[model samples]
Target: MEITMYDKLLQLPLFQGLCQEDFTSILEKVRFEFNKYPAGSCIAQQGKACKQLIFILQGTVYAKSIDNEHGYVLYETFDSPQVIEPYSLFGMFPQYTASYHAQTDISTVSFNKSYVLSELNKYEIFQLNYLNVISNRAQNVYRKLWDTHIGNTAEKITNFLQLRCTKPAGEKTLQIKMEDLATLIDDTRINVSKVLNKFQEEGLIQLKRKEIHIPALEKLIEQYT
Candidate 1:
């Protein structure tokens, strides 16, 4: 049990920079329990009190919500070695902001809210990582809102490309397929394909079979914003 949990924790970004000795020491003092969920199950529901912080050890899950008009809206999907709803684990109203469903069979370790808060107080690295997770989540929400409300199809594709491209500067390759990219932006695949072609013709992006290479990110970003 110790060996397995230690290896799993090592994969999580929250523990990324910690040495093995430090990780072992921290785990020795913290209390956590694991659970398994079958595929197509709801892991957590919206508006429920967040008593524990769930850390995904394996499999995939999606945080989704419903709208009167749109029905089920997928906010995001997460793969293994990730934390769920770190931002909602605190504050006066510490409740899940969206429902989480297991897209595949999932294994998770949950730390009691009190246990996590206590550990955060004792470890600077953990505290920093916690803050980073929450800050990044907030920024993602802001970006999604901006893209949905203000961005046109071309701008939306460009913004999504920039976020997924993963290069600091200069040319970068996009590995996502057109269908998946369309689903991500909540747009039609035909429109996305057309936009990609337009960008290709303009020399902003080059599309190959199952790959997209951005030549001038500055030009693409200029159009995005």
Candidate 2:
């Protein structure tokens, strides 16, 4: 497990352009702390300040945004190797600005923001890599936001599923939920539920406890594009 995890950290694309010494430098200043959260636990609550950018080592997490009438809408799902959901390195405002929940057993390596940015700013390569990461994340999110605004609930669901779900081995399961699905597509729970019901009625999707079984993934993909 130790070898495999370190190998994963070494091979991460976000660290691709950096050198071995860079990682050593990071490890010197940044401490590796294991954060464990149970299923359905809140890792980062809504409207809170975040002091560290955590690199996911295991499990999945869902990002959500709070709303007045609808409670919370699912914003997106984040997998491992992402340092926090979105880096606040250069954001005009440094607050977390959103919340995240553990969808399953979670583990991460968190780094202090001050030390991280300090090391990153010293190196031109690291700076570019950081910029690239932030740029791509914001742009992808913007595109999704644009799509969600124009598309209906069904279209939003399609867009979200395409971005989040992976076809599991053997069985054709997508394995997400209405609640987290709400975040991924940038829609409300009420709206997501309504669309899920619509899809089930049409024999397109199967909804379960925090999981989704899609019998027609290709067809759902067809609906999007």
Candidate 3:
């Protein structure tokens, strides 16, 4: 049988572990609105009141943080059938910490904060999973904070490399721009460029305009990490 959008939603972190019966009930009981955004469109802006819990149903979203000196910093990206800023929906002052833009044509279903919270209280498994999601998000932010404030330039660059390095088409590489890296890591473009050059000279990485191919990611990681 072909999987439905409802089935895909059950696979998400927030909705995982829910049986079909319960999932159906929640869908019928809760109120949500679907929204579509074209490619390169802004889904949500930073510091805006987060009144709804948005779940992406299609395409990709690129999240960015505003930097006073460096402009917008690319923080992360998320793909379809996933939640966006669940943590921001709660707390004393709820606001999106980063702006999200559609990387491609995207669709989302959003649940009002009051309704989602009501469901959370009614469902134990959903509540636990929601806590897990928020906890994991918090941990990531904490780690990023440690890396940015405490780690040195070399550490920062290496950490960035470790986090972003991926093997696509069986080739190990990081297809990222130097300027984007600088902005993401809150480092100067010159410093980021210099470190990448040093890594290249040391036979650690091969640099292209927007791609950094690591000969052996383990070796590169071991040197600094």
Off by over 4 Å in 3: 1-3, 69-72, 143-152, 159-192, 199-224
Q: What are the clashing pairs of model 2?
A: 74-182, 74-183, 75-183
lDDT of each: 0.73, 0.63, 0.73
User: What are the RMSDs of all candidates, in order?
Assistant: 7.8, 6.4, 5.7
* Candidate rank order under lDDT: 3, 1, 2
Q: Please, what are the lDDT tens digits per residue for candidate 2 over residues 1-225?
A: 545556657555456676667766766666667678887887776556667766777888766654445333334565665456446534666666556678778877666668666665686776776678788766766665566545887887776555432221112344454676677567799998887888778887777775566665667666554
Q: lDDT by residue for model 3 over 103-163, one digit each (tens)?
A: 8999888888888767756999988988998887667656655665247666787776444
Q: Pick out the ten consecutive residues of candidate 3 with the lowest summed lDDT.
A: 162-171
Cand. 2 Cα-lDDT: 0.63
Report the alpha-carbon TM-score of model 3 versus the true structure. Answer: 0.71
Candidate 2 accuracy as TM-score: 0.63
TM-score of candidate 1 relative to the true fold: 0.63
For the record, the alpha-carbon RMSD of candidate 2 to the native fold, in angstroms, is 6.4
Clash totals, every prediction = 0, 3, 0
